[model samples]
Target: MNSLADPRVADLLARLHDEADAQRRLIRDRVASLADEAPGPEAWPHHMKDFYLPVSREQGRFLYQTVRATGARQVVEFGSSFGVSTIYLAAGLRDNGHGVVTGSEVVGEKAETARTNLAAAGLDGHVEIRTGDARTTLADPGGLVDLLLLDGGPGLYLDILQLLMPRLRVGAVVIADNITDSGAEPHPYARWVRDPDNGFVSNSITLKGGTEYSVWIGLP
Candidate 1:
């Protein structure tokens, strides 16, 4: 009963991966210029509105599998972009027979589009896309989160994680994307998660963009 293998979910994911691949070149060029011009996340949603800087297909599958394996009922996603990852998370929840994916995206347009895509995949009922700063929109997830995905701005990873710390149940899993390139020094988020004092035990996983897979062990 793999929901990802369902025609609706699989077809949508295929289309999304293709779309992301097509935007690689444009995203590379736009990001280079945006880095010099705007230089921060404030302008990203607007400038990169047309781009899909989304998670890789492999990452999406990992997220889905994590939800299923953990029997997660509440999932939080920081930076859903156009909802590519949201669909994966939602599908997992749907197949779990219950659960929901709370997604935050600063761009209203992208959020709307993401909702549309989820609807197309028949997973909208399992997802709620909030359009605003994740720091605020996800302030209260209403219940303990079983899994968290940090796929938004690299700079805000730690901040968002800390903010949601109180609501993450023990043994909760947190996955942060784009932490570092292969062989590069760990990103700040990685450093923080890998510190035992912070209540997590984490290590990097080789994904398209470096991924930090961590588990909550409670404060030392």
Candidate 2:
């Protein structure tokens, strides 16, 4: 029942993860160069266009399991760079027998590349990659979202969450990446979701890039 174990998916994941590892130095250098001007999040897509910035194999597996466990029919992913994570999400849907992972990527080239990669994994049928700003591309998911993955620009995490909240089914899962505890303060997204007043019960878990797992409880 694990579509991720399929040879096509397993092989592609290995290659993508290896590629991401090789780009570590370039990513670090790019971030360091931005230390001076402190460019806004909008500048990140351009700077990171060429990088894989993929989720770790563990994180991808977690995503797959979450989808299967939840029986999620509608999943949305923000920041599907090159679709490494998208492949995992889509694989989950395929194994579940029905569902779709709607992904957004601002970089047009990355979106196309992601589509190709998904096809290579034999998962293109379970995903839709929308190439444009998530705010616009993800405006209407066409149905209630059963799960949402926030792996895009940190600054836009809250914005995108708010935008999609209305369409998120009660008890829906929300997984945010890069929510590390390296900072003295809790990340804004984590803070918002952890507050019961915000209608979510959330907790941060030790996983690749630090994962914030939350469930929508609806307003009290």
lDDT comparing candidate 1 with the true structure: 0.91
Which residue pairs of candidate 1 clash?
Answer: none
Flag clash pairs in model 2: none
Task: Please write out the lDDT profile of model 1 over residues 1-220, one tens digit for every residue.
Answer: 7889999999989998898899888888997888779755687678988888889999999999999999999999999888999998998898899999999999898899999999999999999999999999999988999999998888899889999999999999999999883355667778889989999999989887589999998999
Candidate 2 CA-lDDT value: 0.92
lDDT of each: 0.91, 0.92
Clashes of each: 0, 0
Query: After superposing candidate 2, which stretches have Cα over 4 Å from the reference?
Result: 182-184
Worst 10 residues of 2 by lDDT: 180-189
Candidate 2, RMSD to the unseen true structure: 1.3
